[model samples]
Target chain A: MSSLGSKWKPVIVMVINDRKLRFGQIAARIHVISRKVLTDQLREMVEDGLLIREEFKELPPRVEYTLTEKGLALLPILNLLEDWERNYETKEVLAEA
Target chain B: MSSLGSKWKPVIVMVINDRKLRFGQIAARIHVISRKVLTDQLREMVEDGLLIREEFKELPPRVEYTLTEKGLALLPILNLLEDWERNYETKEVLAEA
Candidate 1:
């Protein structure tokens, strides 16, 4: 979703990939992101159909964020990103080609 | 890199990948990024050894930017990101497994 841009997309997608998490839980993983920013990102993801938000009729209200099929589809890409970052940080100037 | 985080890193690295570009040139490629933000991103790329900046003495001054060996190393990964984004955007809710 190149046009559907968000700085934390990769990070958030990678974290809540397989399992669903409530709002606060998701926010906790991506340290330093503001509530406003996370909320905005989540809304965009939902609109893009990348994530599904399910609500429960509980007392304080409960909403769980889970990767839709579209979101799950992003895992491999997110994996690639993680591997790339990992290698980029550890490896020195790369060898030819 | 994972620990060395930045929002614009992927975009900047993708643009100035092969050929070098001046500050203005790089800035133009990524629309809406402020010069200050671009400058900050570039400096970090240089510090992280992902980009090289060369300067020359002239009337108006001259400088160019290009990906380093490490940065070039990022191409495949960036390519993967692009492909992933493209596919994710185009494909419907992915088929299972």
Candidate 2:
């Protein structure tokens, strides 16, 4: 919980679980976050040793990001948070039920 | 997890569990935090409907803060996070422990 991640960090990690993704692809997954913030957060994650960045010398400058082992290690915690939110935080449950 | 809390939110909430506390008290609990930042974060938590702030118009301008129902409901999530941080994220444990 004291990690260097914003509110969308768990969501981003959850989406990219067990896979690598491009910058734009990651941005597209979390709607409405500015390119700057996502990029900044991703860079921070990299610095924090939670992500691995691979750069390729291609026509459009191919770049891919993937979670390191430590990052993958966080999946269970994210799952716990998601479960807590769905079961408690989200305003979807019926009062009668 | 997606709640409007920073690194110290769970720490703060955990410290004040089931108890109402004053502004200075909270600031004191978390070391090295600027009074301004603590005040700002607490105000944001209140705005997020996770905390209740009571202001006493006394000679010293006393103020007390307590978690609302929504805030207290988040205890379990915070507890899970603390557990995760202890068993996983934090830089503790002996090598090969």
Candidate 1 off by > 4 Å: A1-7, A28-37, A91-97, B1-7, B31-34, B91-97
Interface root-mean-square deviation for each candidate?
Answer: 3.7, 3.1
Q: What is residue B21's positional error in candidate 2, in angstroms?
A: 1.3
Q: Mind giving the per-residue lDDT tens digits that candidate 2 earns over B27-97?
A: 87887788888888887888666789999999989999998777787787677666656665444344336
Chain A only: TM-score of every candidate?
0.87, 0.87
**How much is the TM-score of the A chain of model 2?**
0.87
User: Model 2: runs farther than 4 Å from truth?
Assistant: A86-97, B56-61, B86-97
DockQ of each: 0.26, 0.39
Across B22-69, the per-residue lDDT of candidate 1 in tens digits comes to 998888888889999998888888887888889999979999998887
Taken over the whole model, the C-alpha lDDT of each candidate is 0.78, 0.76
Docking class of 2: acceptable
lDDT of 2 at B61: 96
Q: Lowest-scoring 10 consecutive residues by lDDT in candidate 1 chain B? A: B88-97
